[model samples]
Target: MRSKHPPARAAEAGNSTTRQGAASPGVQFLTVPADLAGQRIDNFLQSRLKGVPRSRIYRILRKGEVRVNKGRVKAEYKLQPGDVVRVPPIRTAEQAPAPVAGDQLRQLVEASILYDANGLLVINKPAGLAVHGGSGVRLGLIEVLRQMFPESQFLELVHRLDRDTSGAIMVARKRAVLTHVQGDLRAGRLEKSYLALAVGKWPRGRRLVEAPLRKNTLKSGERMVSVDPEGKPSETRFQVLERFRGATLLAAEPVTGRTHQIRVHAQFVGCPLAGDSKYATDEANRAFREVGLKRLFLHSSVVGCSLPGGQEVRVEAPLSEELESVLAELRSGTGVPLQP
Candidate 1:
């Protein structure tokens, strides 16, 4: 899971790219080899990825990104060597990309109603809060939607956002746009862009991390990511915009769609998301939390595409105040920024 396509061709579904939200994102499923079947999940990935890495490998394991026996399994468990490792579709910004709720969220829907004909509602989604429901998340973007638009005939998500991510989200008022958009994403047409706060310093200029990603599953269904040859191909490009103490503000463009591709790739290169608890060290998480960084430090800044009928739609949203505050602290050179 690396990147989505470019901006111009983002919306041309009746087969030329930009077809996301018309249907579920397209996916190709393949299983790991049985020859390396009996090895431990982590060990196998580590060996296969020679120049890749171990921390990322182990992290993928914890996320249950990697599978054994054709289903989700732990990393510590010994593989029978031939056990099939199922690599699930990694979520780019489109993954679990739930919408935002609150007075502000409603305002966005009403304000950015690009084209609301026949049940297709395209609006910018804010970072944080999921598009759908999941563990530890009760009220999500869609849930709040039902509260306000209760009588609407159809209000379903075309995709998702990580709990901390935000950006262009597509909603299907009717089933037609939903079906078409999903089909388009599958065909690799629609694309998305994101702005994130990364941990640590970066190279002097634009950099790219391209690696095959394999999700490693650990006990209790924890999933982590890593760069491995035995894993599916994943790529990420970064442009360092600003550098702060122990962190960098970057505009990351993922080439292949993968779970935490930006996060994982950043961490793989020694720069996890500053406020991320899933991949960063406990100290960093604690430090950022003290500075009012209560949420993930990623934001989906813009989304656009060419639609049928020669319509081009683009939506943009700002980063959350929480993240903004932290950036301000970094910018102001505050005394060891406070945490949440």
Candidate 2:
């Protein structure tokens, strides 16, 4: 039988620090800070082991190599104040360094800020930028923000938007703020609305879709969501905002925060989103492409929530120039309308 422990590597043992770059060669012991209390163990490890791959971190946790207060804990274990964590040695410097953010990108991000108060930072995140680095993406908004504000000790995403979806996203500068905002989201106290262009003209009345969604992984490792009875319960409320010759502009509010809830729900109602390569029919996508649609026609238009200090905030992001231009063309009736 194989030994359960990882192979011993020769190095000095010491307390771990938050510095990025190479992982320590020896086993490291870390004390959980009060601010980090209630964070999941896996997330905590990822934050501390900046250069380590997420897979490696999960593997360590599965093999019982990671211990909290000298006891093996699951990855979902919530960290507590004063908890001591033990981490095994692993090489991390072998990975390439994260990509640097250019000056232009920095300025764009700074200019996109919509709200910066009460421990919350909101930005009108541009399309094509991932929220965090993973897969083939070397750097994302979180990493860029880290580079931008090196003096800040903590900055974490309150929620996520798809890479192709441009809109209001919140980042918490303090742990308490993260907890409070996320709590509101879970309790349905936060209101989030998106603007979407559907391939077909939607029905006139507001509709509430109560469809359960199941996530599937294709043979090529792509993730997709579809309606299934056995899946998690999902709900989306949609209202028609405008009707075009070939498409409908709508406001979508997700009552249940399932992955791709709005996109999949729209498809379930016989109106797939325009420019959605993964979910929409090729002919529909081609038709939209012909009319100046370059990317997914989805935007996070609004987010409203109460802050930790009881102050309410409502943030909105205007449609991008490209999206606005697409609408303008549709309004002009320049191209042939798509067949229903």
Candidate 3:
């Protein structure tokens, strides 16, 4: 990343004093390509902004810094191909800052590479790790990825797995590749699936989840998801694969990506995942947690996408052995009736 000490200009000295923020007010222009036309403004920024957080993209839109074809567009406005977009200069020091991950976390993320081909890098992210730094999380997987692959200039994430969800993550080795892959994802041409276990004898069969997700913040500041029409639409197609004593192991395929969409929707349908402490009921959560179900029982098991070379790549990361063992214990304990 280039470090340009703002030219000591009449622009607010206090604003430019900080060595960081988002889009350097030095101002840059982005041309919407033909394939990516008709995408939403916020989604467009989410893909285009290099390091800025996705949550903050809407904030920039409200600031009028993102203009489409010389006019401000709504966050929901669909962008047309070849639309000229102006990305106003921001104090680089404030918005999309550099990685602040500690040494240990950085080392772990760098060493988890599964493969690297051309302008695409593959990583097997472990559970209990965040993909990027956020929400007071000091170290995320991407922080280390950047530290180790600095020479791979223009590195960026094609998609996010989740904070606690572990699995194969794909990174773009080059900027053009990043944008191209994102085009495929936004067009509903990309596919990713997860493996999970749900509690309480679910009906044997495949089920489709059509849940609208809305963010609801708890008093403790922890955010959660709930079913609300006002919320964003989310879908997950699930099929029961195995049945435990009181649980059914299933394969979850999320059709639409939404925060906490899978976990919340699964619970809403009457079967909370075995170890989900956040949305699971007290009895189910406590009973499972006692048997070593400490973290959320969700793993992004597979990632599939089309590369710039026109080749399809699919990678799978099995669930952690520890989580699997915990599931075994939970199933066995139900029959033995272990004392609390």
Candidate 4:
């Protein structure tokens, strides 16, 4: 969706040039091509209209300033092939130079490819990197990939991971693949699992958490998710993987994808994720950091999904070396068995 042109094909114009009066001011109509058929209208605008704030895009949609096939369309409307979209004229900032990726990030991304075939790229995404550029992050993983492959026609993230979470994440090289995978995700056919280090000893046996979570924005503009009765239903399954003196390693699989679902559920169980700054106590985070953990101890370890042709894809990412080092130190210090 973050492409000026329809993913990989040339888009037709509707009584206007593709870049109709971009330097001036006037409405322009664009015809969607087959390659961009399933992209959401809001996302399409975000890509086409550079330097426009997301809030403005939503406002335009709400005000009926944006239209599809001569009729007003919602922000979430999926653009259909051959649909003519009416885009209002708006001022935009001058384009800035793209940010350069650091050597460490380049090397890590280059080495993290777990699967690449049939228009899909599965990566063992590194921790501390945003998936897409925004919110002061100029060079995210996707931007880096685009820079790395300048000649490529299209590439987009299939899903998102938190900035501090490292693990298997998917990127689509083909628009069709992106559409298919997204459908699978929406249908809950895609399965994902994560490895997390919790603050306290985990109880023996499997645990299932089914809670409703609501998102809240703080005065500082920071976003948080908490368990609320009026919120959306969320579910997570946690299995104790290994135990330490005052900490536990767990395998967490989420049935419903909500913002910070696993972290909130972990906190609800009185075992907030180690090094989770938003949910865990400062004292607990400080303790874990003192023991050599510097980032959130959550990682997307496994992902499974089927492609359009019924070919299944399952990828796994091992615990990072930095995390492994911390686990080793903890194990040696406590001399605890792997499991209870």
Candidate with more favorable, higher TM-score: 2 or 3: 2
Of 1 and 4, the candidate ranking higher by lDDT: 4
Mind giving the per-residue lDDT tens digits that candidate 1 earns over 72-124? Answer: 76655655533445433333433232334678767755664544664567655
Clashes of each: 73, 0, 13, 0
**Model 2 ranges off by over 4 Å:** 1-15, 18-31, 40-42, 53-86, 93-95
Which 10-residue window in model 4 sums to the lowest lDDT? 1-10
**Candidate 4 displacement at residue 49 in angstroms:** 2.9
Task: Choose the strongest candidate by TM-score.
Answer: 2
Which tens-of-lDDT digit does each residue in 1-340 have in candidate 4? 1324432343464224323224524566678878888888876776676555556677789899887876998977988888878777675443344567887888889899899888899999889888877665677888788777778777888888988899999998888889999899888889899999998777666499999999999999689999999999999999998888779999999988898999999999888998899999888887787778899999999998888777899999998998998899888865322222
Candidate 2 local lDDT, 41-157, one digit each (tens): 877877777676665677899899888877999976888877778777666554445578999989989988999998999999999999877656667888889899999988888
Model 4 per-residue lDDT at 81: 84
Error of model 4, residue 320, in angstroms: 1.4
State the C-alpha lDDT per candidate.
Answer: 0.62, 0.83, 0.70, 0.81
338 Cα displacement, candidate 1 (Å):
14
Cα RMSD, each candidate: 15.0, 4.3, 6.5, 5.2
| Alpha carbon deviation, residue 97, candidate 4 (Å) | 4.0
TM-score of each: 0.61, 0.87, 0.74, 0.84
